[model samples]
Target: MSDSKKADQKKAIVFLCDGTEEMEFTITVDVLRRAKVDVTVVGVNIAKEFALCSRGVKITPDEKFSESLSSGNYDAVVIPGGNGTASILGDHEGAKKLILEFYESKKIVAFICAGTLVAEKAGIPHKHTVTSYPAFKSELEKVYNYSEDRVVVDENVITSRGPGTTFLFALTIVEKLLNVKTVNSLKNEMLTCSSL
Candidate 1:
């Protein structure tokens, strides 16, 4: 693509590992792409060919995590949550490093459900308020100012509750990274409720 063409587009990368929440992963990517964002799916610590989701669904990543980091100039980095996904990514040095890189660069770092755990694990300071899956509230609250809102955007760190809230989470990212006009167009195209 021409530099001008690329400059006209918003790019995002979604990180996935084995046991990622299927809905959160899929919905976020779908919504962002529908908004005309260029979305790349990266597999972290999983086979280059595919990653098995929490429900046993399989997905092929567009690139490996390292490859994405090396070559991608994204507006945002997204993480979709699941029980195992949180545990694995939270402990991954690469994942943590990437989160810190994005955070430091003032780029959008978005997560949903248990994926919020990765923020605390990545050693982000506790100043940013956030929200996450209810089960992780206690742990995350110790670090972030916690909220029960379906979606929380504290500066560039955007977080959300869980699978059911994935669309709103993704839409919020679209609004922040792209524009409200794009988000409004996507909501109509995706047939989402206006209030959402």
Candidate 2:
């Protein structure tokens, strides 16, 4: 494809990983790549090897956070749930800053399970509906001031519960970033899975 055609066709998605939930990160990566989105897995630390997920699976990142941030290009930022990943993202000044900047720019920001903690810590208002692991609801409720009963999508931010909702969360992000038609097609292709 030519530069203009590539630019017009590509939609960039960055997945920040540091011990993320294996299924959440892998499922999102797999589904988005299947849809032909330009997806990049960004390493949040100095380790060059694949990061180990909560389930003991290792995933190789596509690029380092330093490099991707320096490039200053991406259409969306996705965070996968894993307490370790969430804690690292919550404390990383650079990641938090970029997340806030992306949100301010009105780009899609998605988090699932414990990943929502990073968003809450980054100051995404609780008033913006959100859902996460039941154990973490109080943390989000305190910040956003709204108690969400189920999976919630507020504007460009999407949040879901735990492993049970991973597929739906991934599809929801796809639906938001691309379109409902693409999401429907993907769902139809993966007929075993239910719709969002």
TM-score winner: 1
Off by over 4 Å in 1: 1-3, 67-72
Candidate 1 achieves a global lDDT of: 0.88
Cα lDDT of all candidates, in order?
A: 0.88, 0.77
Candidate 2 clashing pairs, residues 3+ apart or interchain: 126-144, 127-144
Per-residue CA lDDT of candidate 1, range 5-110, in tens?
A: 8788988889989999999999999998887789989888885478999999999999877724732477888989997678888888987888888888889999
lDDT of 2 at 180: 83
Least well predicted 10-residue stretch by lDDT in candidate 1:
65-74
Tens-place lDDT per residue, model 2, 27-132, is 8887787676788788787355778778778788877776247324667788888887798889888888878877888888888889999997787765687888
Model 2 spans with C-alpha error above 4 angstroms: 46-48, 67-72, 145-150
